[model samples]
Target: MQLNYSIEGGDFTNAGNASSQVKKILKKLNVDPKITRRVVVALYEAEVNVAAHAYRGEIIVDINTERIRVVLKDEGPGIESIENAMTEGFSTASAEVRQMGFGAGMGLPNINKNADELNIKSDVGVGTELEIITKLK
Candidate 1:
């Protein structure tokens, strides 16, 4: 199955909408609980990243018998240094964002930990794209 979702930057109220909907879809499909949990974690973090940093973004999800793949692409000031950005406790979120309790610097790390395969590509002034993959097992 395939699904898509749109996100608006700085929209805290709707930040987790895509993730929540994906979780429901997984549950309805009777996916494994552990896999579902991990997917939710990764998906939520990815969604939040777009909301916290991008001007706008979209999420595309593909699911098959063996694995699930999610692509999150956003229009924003992309990460300057992906290496540094991936570090735990490192973030570029604004003060207002931090004050909202969304940018704790754990988003990427958490997604990395939960996703079986995580790939991120970013352009400094353009945008960022993340691909998170997980096996159904």
Candidate 2:
């Protein structure tokens, strides 16, 4: 199965909708509870990242018998340093975003922890794309 979601920048109120929907689908599919939890957490973090940093983006989710994959693509200011961006406490979110209780810099790390495979590619002046895969076990 495949699912796609558009994420609007700065839309904190709807940040978790995509993740919520994915969670519901996984439940209906009878996916393992632990796997569902991990998938939902990773999806939520990726969705929030787009809302907090990107101008706009879309998340594409694909589910197969053995694994679930999520791709987040954004047309926003790309990461200057992938190394730094992957760090737990590194973030470029604005003060206004921080005020909304996000941008605490935990998004990427949390995603990494929940995903069996995570990849991020970015160009400083271009954009960013993230691919995450979690195995069904």
Candidate 3:
């Protein structure tokens, strides 16, 4: 199955919408609870990252019998350094974002921990893209 979702930056009210929908679909498909949890965790982290940092974003999800792949792309001030961004407790979120309690700097770390395979690319002035993959079988 394939699914797509759009995200508006600074829209915390709906930051988890895509992840929530995917969780429901995984449950209905009888996916293993543990795997589902991992996927959801990774997805939620990515989703929130876009909402907190990007100008706008898109999430594309593909699910098959063997695995699931999620691609998150956004238009915003991209990361200056993926290495720094991946570090725990490292973030460049605006003060306003921090005030909302959404930028604890754990997003990438959590996603990395939960995804079986992860890839990230960014252009400092362009945006960022993240691909998270997890095995289903």
Best by lDDT: 3
Name the lDDT of candidate 1. Answer: 0.93
> What RMSD does each model have against the real structure?
0.7, 0.9, 0.8
Worst 10 residues of 1 by lDDT: 10-19
Quote the RMSD, in angstroms, for model 2. Answer: 0.9
TM-score of 3: 0.97
Candidate ordering by TM-score (highest first): 1, 3, 2
lDDT of 3 by residue, 44-104 (tens): 9999999998999999999999999999999999999899989999998889888888788
Question: Where does candidate 2 stray beyond 4 Å?
Answer: none
Give lDDT tens digits, candidate 1, residues 1-137. 99999999988899888889989999999999899999998999998899999999999999998999999999999999988888999998999999989788998989999999999999988999999999986
Residue-by-residue lDDT tens digits, candidate 2, 68-97: 999999988888988887899898888998
Better of 2 and 3 by lDDT: 3
The positional error of residue 85 in candidate 3, measured at the CA in angstroms, is 0.6
Runs with alpha carbons beyond 4 Å of true place in candidate 3: none
Q: How accurate is candidate 3 locally (lDDT)?
A: 0.94
Task: List TM-score per model, in order.
Answer: 0.98, 0.96, 0.97
Off by over 4 Å in 1: none
